[model samples]
Target: MSEQFERLSRLPLRDDLRGKHPYGAPQLDVPILLNVNENTYGVPDDVRQAIVEAVSREVVGLNRYPDREFTELRTNLARYLGHGLTPENLWAANGSNEVLQHLLQAFGGPGRSAIGFPPTYSMYPLLASSTGTRYIAGRGNEKFDLNAEDAAREVRQSGANLVFLCSPNNPSGSALGLDVVEAVYEASEDAQAIVIVDEAYAEFAHSGTVSALSLLAGRERLVVSRTMSKAFAMAGTRLGYLASAPEVADALRLVRLPYHLSAITQAAANAALTHSDLLLANVENIKVQRDRIVAGLLQLGLTPVPSDANFVLFGGLDDPHRIWQGLLDGGVLIRDVGIPGHLRVTAGTETETTVFLETLGALLERAVS
Candidate 1:
């Protein structure tokens, strides 16, 4: 623990939160950063111009609080999601993390427990703990594949109040099949549990991969979360939203602070949605780079998980931290996801991808020699 942490720990703290490190990826000033799975392609010029104009319109209106209901924002998000969703079925927050926190605040807390499969998004546990929800560490197969039967069995057995299924899961880059979502939801029926499919990276999924959004109809307990951070290239925008039954939105309203989303945030997100096609054009480029990274890793004798998301996770490193540090030393950065013999890297531009693969290949060759 750092001196600051030691002092902070001295003060009274929640038992679950003590000795915890916050959810953060390294925020270093590296030339190429693939560490955080960001959409490094950035916003297209057309969408950028639109967002600037929209935000400018909101500047004078900043004197007033943002639309407390975030009405127009929800309308845009609902239309963008396009499974016949309406504003009543949508909710938004600063980020997917906050959107998740809202869910936990509403459905999870105190004696209720939440569960997530391992090798998944790190924030699930943090969100659970912060909300006073007991966190259950669920499991997946040795290869990190989470099958439907296995997933449903655990949900059924745990009787967890909130089940977080991180499809195209973070740090692994593998997506859960729709069958898995269906099975888990069915398993939760008797328990009346809330099944949350965190689809932050949904837009990056490979062709023909169906989203949990398709399963939302009549499944009042099901929630599908998405973010503009990835495909929309709006990480700085901090806009994440969910599609669910209207009742879920009502539950969140009880917990979300009034005027939570600022007017500028609402306007910018609406502009991005208006030009969703332009912003999403770069997704194909990212998918290409992601596949390229996977191929390069395999050629270098590393085992990369086949990905549906905008990043790739790989194993076969004898010392992952050493490899991570070596990459950083070479002015590149990727994630050391704390899995033994594994690390994750976002799909950057073609040029950045080339540099990362080259740097890593050289490091391995040198280590062997």
Candidate 2:
């Protein structure tokens, strides 16, 4: 082999992910997929038409590179947010995942640390590790509620430069209290650390909880990340956004790739924003289905976490893997949360939910016998 090839083979990658794949969950061909928390509904016809129109209008511009700054999309997004957001306070990326990665690169690095609340999103720790920052987890309370006091103490102790919180948290579907989030924000102030609230499911929880954006009046270090992937039925489109103070937005821009978002994606996202009301209606339907599922699980002697998101988590099954496999064999796929004895099931259409519950009933009866 050539000397260059030999040198490449000799270099070892970072120890944090020596032999790891970044993404979780394997892809499977199934009739009904309730595993990944995707909105079961398809995009509305009006939104689809708008996207077509947007793409048609932008076709002429394809010969040249897209707007590196994504000016129009940023301005439109800021206006849509309607809570003190301006173009200067907005940033867009391939997805919220990418926005998160930019934040890590901007605020986390060698000799620095970031804090995460466990049984939350799995990506936070992975992102922190990838950026060469120390990742620490503070366990959530009994109800899966974030312990703000403990979080603040740990951040102060570790001198962490970033803290990540996910409302309507993944796998558990519990929304963190606004007061707790604000407390953590205040505690991180002295350390000059950034507080990121991932509001990926905010639309689903719109009826009750206050968004982190609503609490961003004087907080310069707080950043709120949202995605169109959840309630908007556009996970395949890959559009995510961040709302923050202008200074923090500037920091994210500095670390993100130039032209990180494509013109096509920007157009699709803008189109989707215009049809948010229609999307919310779909969310309402999913919420109804979620409630039904939760009640059904309880009847089967399972305890489900109270959820505001479009998914539910339940306990009582001894081996979740067996239940997961049984559901798959019955043509319904649900998520096997890493937490032993617990499983997460995303809300599908009314009919799909019915099929899932019927299948699960049969499986549980067999297990009991």
> How do the predictions measure up, each by TM-score?
0.98, 0.94
Residue 349 displacement (Å), model 2:
0.6
Best by TM-score: 1
Model 2: pairs clashing at backbone N, Cα or C within 3 Å: none
Q: State each model's CA lDDT, in order.
A: 0.92, 0.86
lDDT for position 29 in model 1: 93
Model 1: how far residue 184 lies from native, Å: 0.6
For model 2, what is the alpha-carbon lDDT of residue 264? Answer: 91
Cα RMSD to the true fold for all candidates: 1.0, 3.3
Q: Kindly list the per-residue Cα lDDT of model 1 for residues 215-333, writing each as its tens digit.
A: 99999999999999889988988989999999999999999998899898899999999899999999999999999999999999999999999999999999899899999999999
Q: Over the full model, what C-alpha lDDT does candidate 2 score relative to the true structure?
A: 0.86
Our tally of clashes for model 2 stands at: 0
Clashes in model 1: which pairs?
none
